[model samples]
Target: MVERCKDAGITILPSAGPVAEMFNGKKIASSTRARDLKEGQYPAAVYVPRADTVERFLAPQSTSATAPSRAPHAILI
Candidate 1:
């Protein structure tokens, strides 16, 4: 995955297996098709698709940031 991303610049690839995020022992997100994103020199980060996330556990915040390649992203509270 890393090698492929390095060759293509920033890229997203499927994870090897199920991935989940937990907070205070409660699952907030999970996915079998989670994506592994590699950008620049940063460490790879896993992103679970919105459809698979537990929306109830998230609260929108007023903060947001824009990137050159993507839309403005809101901060989750």
Candidate 2:
């Protein structure tokens, strides 16, 4: 999935907070959704990444290189 995103010129920046807390403390750090998932408080842990925060990074991309690809649409988890 990540490779496919890269191929489509969509760079992925994953959150390492979960992993870092898990490994450092030997416990899965709880997030609202993680805890909700555990307790069945919701069907799924849905998240929409804030692309606006990374606007500066995408701003410099060349038009041709960054044109949206049609093969695959965006996926969020």
Candidate 3:
């Protein structure tokens, strides 16, 4: 996935959180110990893939020229 993103000119920033350092590569998993945020924290970060990259990854074998894309779901901290 990292190689594919790089090939498509997508930049993957460092994963954030306590165990983030363990994932040296572009992909990582995250979890929260708290049930939810304290209250004031906004969406500090969001992961949105590039349109073309999403299209390519999702519709590689698609014969149709168009693929419907929707806004990515946002996760609150």
Task: Write the residue-wise lDDT of candidate 2 on 25-70 in tens digits.
Answer: 4432333221111112424332323332223222332224335543
Task: Estimate candidate 3's alpha-carbon lDDT, on a 0 to 1 scale.
Answer: 0.29
lDDT, candidate 2, equals 0.30
Model 1 residue 20 CA deviation in Å: 1.0
Which stretches of candidate 3 lie above 4 Å from their native place? Answer: 1-4, 18-45, 48-77
Per-model C-alpha RMSD: 3.4, 13.6, 14.3
Output the worst ten-in-a-row residue range by lDDT, candidate 3: 31-40
lDDT values, one for every candidate: 0.75, 0.30, 0.29
Better of 2 and 3 by lDDT: 2
Candidate number with greatest TM-score: 1
lDDT of candidate 3 over 38-71, digit per residue (tens) = 1124432334323212232232332342323312
The prediction achieving the highest lDDT against the true structure is 1
Per-candidate TM vs. native? 0.76, 0.18, 0.19
